[model samples]
Target chain A: MSLLDIQDLTIEAKQGQGRQAIVDRVSFAVPEQNIVALVGGSGSGKTTTGLAVMRLLSPGLNIVSGRIYFEGNDVVAMPEGELRRYRGKQMAMVFQEPLYAFNPVFRVGCQIEEVLQFHTDLTKGQRQQRVDALLRQVEIKDPGRVARSYPYQLSGGLRQRAMLAQAIAANPKLVIADEPTSNLDVTVQARILTLFKKLRDDLKLTVLIITHDLGLVRSLADQVVVLSSGRVVEEGPAGEVLQHPRHVYTQQLLEAAK
Target chain B: MSKDKHFVPSPGGLRNFRKNPWAVCCLIILGVFYAGAFLADFVSPYSYQNEDRSYSYCPPMEIQFLDEEGRLARPFVYGVTISFDEFHKRNYIIDKAEKYPLKFWMKGDTYQFLGLIPSSRHLFGVDAPGRLMIWGADARGRDLFSRIVYGGRVSLSIGLLGVAISFTIGLLVGGIAGYYGGRIDDVLMRICEMFMMIPGFYLLLALRAMVPADFNSVQVYFSIVVILSFIGWASLARIIRGMCLSIREREFVLAAKVMGLSDFRIIVRHILPHTLSYSIIAIMLSIPGYILAESALSLIGLGIQDPYASWGNLLSEAMGIIQINFSPWILLPGFFIFLAVMCFNVIGDALRDCLDPHFQVDENI
Candidate 1:
């Protein structure tokens, strides 16, 4: 069975007098131990869809009608208290900017430990060890130094890795990364992509990567869901979809990437 | 096994604060004043109520370190002979014939130390028949230096108590309003605006007027604190609310929300802490206002009554031209007020710089 099944999910953005659908009946799924790239240009509702999967849409945006199933439970219908149990433990998210994602005041290790504290019954010592282990899992050279430093103290690549460490700290089955590699340099981006593949290979982790980078999709995604405007234009295996474009928008996106 | 061995916790702002010389200086000055306030009974030679009417309008008696032969001697203060001037005003002339040597840890007035331990020993005092008025004597012949020390307890503490009360209310009201926007924000922000619309001084006066005439000095002190805090919190609430509104939108706050941290946890631990640097500066800046407000009320005979010293009530004796002209030492309380206010502002400015994220500490550390 698929780890996450998002079916007929319609999200609306409230503007002045009327509500406008930002994600129109968006349907997608991520199988176990797979990477699904929700590819789109700016304002294509891919990020909104990702946010909806976690029920974390920004204010004035509503899930008009949707059924977001994670393992069998409907995320859209789950009560707040129960949803909290699933978040950070069963499913986690990483944002586009690691510097902005991490609280500036707290040390990065404490932030990763915050996830472990809530999700696991680990003692402080164990959590500290776990934090170091998680950082090492993301290939951080010195977990101790990176953990001790604040968000701004680290390099961009290190911050991104720290953010990934925080996401996978609780051993969440799925990680929804919203444009995770867009902010990094080409070398760092490739390294982060490789880390994601490594995570899936070693931990059997599932990822729903929301990005506009077709190159990232080609290198990392097993499945591709092309979004144009607020609707999904094409959905297929990444190799088939990239090799033979079915939709005009997909063809145009491929043309633009070339 | 040694996971936290190399974990050096980040210095939030203390390193920057310590590097600031002016802030450190101000902090020391404040420390001295606060220590004096706390140890008033033990430090002051006389209690706040102790007075000798015979020594009225006495100027600051100079402590002599040399005898008539120009040889070194113990510090001593000469007795004052009371005489009437041409206008029948009491004039105190130094009686050089009679002198009393100063002694440290001398037993003078018995009082509760920290309102618990009863003790009579003072830091310094002169023998009976010669009073050591270091800052001079007021119209009531009360030691101005001792009164200032005792009054520091009230004037200094009121600032802290008032700020604590108001900021507690301000932070919670502002945090809740800012975090939970829409209807709650509208109601709270409108209430804050309504408070802001009223002139604070007039509101203070109105609140002061409401205090029953029968309340004792302690009751009056607390009532004034409540009044001052009530007037102070509205503006702080508004400012904190504005900060919260912006901070709630920051990506870190969003990330915290996604972590399934409860709204209260997010607001308190995450959102409120972001506003702390601003709040710290605001708190430091506002303390002076509380001190000045209490002084203003007491200056007009509305605050702490006579016999019970507060810096404000102590300055009340200087309202007359004659008092200001002849006994200028009565205005010494005003100088103390200025000193406290200036120190707080200097520290506030320094703290603002220290708390700034861009404020760079030394790289060698």
Candidate 2:
């Protein structure tokens, strides 16, 4: 059975005078442990689609029509209470800007520990232990020191690693990484991509990666969904989608990615 | 793996607070003031109302003793005998043979320590009947020193009570406005603006004018506290509302909401604590303002009236030119008021620096 299923999903943002549909009748699915990439340029509803799945859309922009199913449960009809439980546990997200993703005031360890504390029945010591392990898993050097350090005290790569550690700490069933490496340098971006690949294989974790970087999809994703102006222009295996030009927008996005 | 096994202290605000010297100094000063206020009766030598008519307007006395030489020893005013100063055309004093021994923790007039424990011990000697005005006499010739010691009780208590009232109102109103935006925010903020638009001083004046003249001193005192608090809360509410509006959108707040935490918990546990540093700093800064306002009102005959000695009521006597020129000691209350305000401000600044996240501490860390 598929882990996630979205059918004919549409979303609109209420502007000053009119409602603008940002995501229109997009559809996709992720099988268990599979990696899927949602590729598009800016304003292509790539991020919005991911947010709609998480139900973390901002005020005035909402899922206008959709059926999102997760493990046979209707995600679109779930109460806010149940949706929150699903987030960071059943599913987790890593935002585009790692700097703003984690709270500046909280230490990296505490931010990760919050997830463990909320989603797991682990005691304080156990939660701390889990956080340390997660940090180490993300290739954080001196995990203890990094755990104790605030976000501002860490380097950009370290902050991104800490955020990823937090996202994975709850042992989420699906991890949605939204342009995770967009803010990193090339070297750091390569390292982060490798880390995500390792985590996905070792833990048999499903991942939904949203990005404009075709190189990332080519390297890691199993399937790809290409979107433009809120519409899915193409969908197929990641290798086929990248090799053959099925849609004009996909070709444009591929050209831009190069 | 072993390195990740141990507990590590987060290097952030807590560590910074510990290393901040100015915050430490402010804390120490504030601690001393609170200790002094709490232990005033135990630490002061005379009762709040003990009278020594002979020593009225006497400059702070220096201890004296007869040397073996038997000549008049180094500069000490002899205990004076009350008599008429015919040259000055007023009652004056003559040097007496006996010195009034300064006492400590000696039994004097009784008082309720914090309105709880009954005690008679004072830190200094009581004045002789009708005098002993270390800070000079009020209109009734009551000792200003004792009044001040006692008045500290009223002034500090009123500041605290008023702050408590203001904080409660501000938190609730601001929380609502911030959590629920749009029309609710608009309506509530409009009310806040309306309150802000009113001339505070004139409004206070009008409120004071409305108070019945027959109301007792205690009633007037409490009423003034309530009035000041009511006026003060609007500013805090507006500030907290703005803070909440921004904080409510924070990911952590949304996370809390997703966790199914009640709205009240989100406000009290999460939202409220974030505003605490600002609120506390504001409260500290506002206290002196409240004190000064109450003092001003009293100085103008609208606050605590005579027989009830606030720093303000005490300074009211100085409005007369004769009192100002001849007995400048009457202005001593004003000096103390300035000292209190300055101390609070300095302490508040220190706290702000301490609580602020930007202040660097332990650069090596």
Candidate 3:
């Protein structure tokens, strides 16, 4: 079995008008120590898939049929309490909107420390040490100053780096990055992608980057799953899929990018 | 003066508050009311319930630093002689010869200091047989000054206590509804609306009417606080619910969820703090509402019970224009009520402005 197996995942959205499937019968796999990119256009339900596994799906949406197995454990079948324990300690997520991803009231260091607090029994001093180290690993030059600052104080690039720091704070098995670089400029995006490659190689971290930016997948992902309107159109080695696309939808997406 | 280059000013909430002079003034006024409530025993020479039959309808005595001979002397009050007019109205004339020097820390009536320590050492008093009636006596001859002091304790406390209960419910209920939307939101919000639909005062009246009239003063005080809270929470919950509808969508709240923090923890640590900042000002604004609510109930003989002092029942005596015209000093409690309500309004408004996040941002921590 693959390290992470998502089998026939189906998610539905219930609006005032009616209930409609947002992502239907979607399936994918990621072996251990591999970087897989969930590539799709807007409204393709790439982000929803990440949320479903975390059980952090938005209010109006529901996972109707799916079984996500991480390390041979069924995530969809886990109890709420167990699911909570499984979240920060075993797996973490980095969202696209870093500005909205942080609690505005607290300092960045304090926000990062909360995950350590909830998951690990690290001493206060030890936790502070860990936060500083994490910030440095994410390539923050002034880890001390950055940690003390609030979310609104930092620039978009710095905030995204702080977000990446939070995603890796617990040193979890899998780190899900949902459209992580979609909000950054090309220069900053390149830097963040470089950081991701470094983390995956140095820590042997398993990563899942969900993005509409096909360019991001070329540099970072080992495997690519191309999705169009909630359906997977192609799946193979990242280089193979990017160089010679099979599905017409994948061809159109690549053509649009070019 | 040597200026240091590294000295960057911190622009936090306290500094922002100090920048607004109006909030400071209101804060000082509230400090006075809290002081009066805290020191009611030491400040009031006579007990709130003490009534002297002969002193009824007597005009307030004038405390003078100059003796009758015009020599500068200790503060003293002159005894007054009472006489009946043709219409059965009582009048008073200060007897210059009967000088009663004011005493401080004098042992007098017993009272529980802070309702904890037993002490009867009053702050000041006059010689026996001459009342230093600054605010004068009521129809029952009860010392109005003492009653006002005692009344401050009840009227002011109800506001804080009532708003506390109300906000606790509002934050918890509204947070849950907004966080776990859908069926939960629909049900909880329907319950909240059911509370909002009824006319507040009538609802207060209906609830207050349910309490037996025979319950003791303390019981009545608790009931009034509870009734006011019930009437107050729904409106606040509606506001909180509206805020939560948007706040739950914020990225940090989502981050907390993805981190596996329990729903309760997310609501309390992450979500509730956002509402609490707004609630702090809301609590201050609504306190006067509670004070007024208590006063209205007492005015109609449904509140705080007779002989138990509260700003409300004390003003109940001045309901008739005839009594107000005869002895305006009886309106002393009315002045306190006005001061309390007005100070709260000013303080609330000041807090709302001062605590705004965009007030003035400085780079320093």
DockQ for each candidate? 0.30, 0.09, 0.37
For each prediction, how big is the interface RMSD? 7.3, 7.6, 8.6
TM-score of each: 0.89, 0.80, 0.89
lDDT of each: 0.90, 0.77, 0.87
Candidate 2: tens digits of C-alpha lDDT, residues A1-258: 989999999999999899999999999898899999998888999888887888878789988898999988988999977887788788888877655555555677887887787788999999999988999999987999999986667777888888888888888889888899988888999999999889998887899999999988999899999888999889999889889978988888788878
Ranking by TM-score: 1, 3, 2
Q: How would the docking of model 1 be graded?
A: acceptable
Error at A40, model 1, angstroms: 2.1
Going through the candidates in order, what fraction of the true interface contacts does each contain? 0.52, 0.04, 0.66
* Candidate 2 chain A: 10-residue stretch with minimal lDDT: A97-106
Task: Give the lDDT of residue A102 in candidate 3.
Answer: 89
- Full candidate order by DockQ, most accurate first: 3, 1, 2
Return the TM-score for candidate 2, rounded to 2 decimals: 0.80
Per-residue CA lDDT of model 2 for B1-365, tens digit only, reads 12221122233334455565755665676566566667777765555555554455444343555543676664333454545565653344534554455455667677788789899777766444322334555554455666776666666677788889988998888988888778988998898888789998888898888888899988999999988888888889888999999988876665444333456766876677678778878988888888888888989989987666677877888899976776677788787778777777876776666665545345578
Between candidates 2 and 3, name the one with more favorable lDDT. 3
Candidate 2 wrongly placed segments (more than 4 Å):
A116-127, A201-204, A243-245, A255-258, B1-35, B51-77, B84-90, B104-121, B126-133, B139-141, B164-180, B202-226, B239-284, B297-309, B317-327, B345-365
Model 1: how far is A102 from its true place, Å? 1.3
Ranking 2 against 3 by DockQ, winner = 3
User: What's the true lDDT of residue B344 in model 1?
Assistant: 99
- Candidate 1 on B119-146: residue-level lDDT in tens? 8999999988779999899878889999
* Model 1 lDDT on a 0 to 1 scale: 0.90
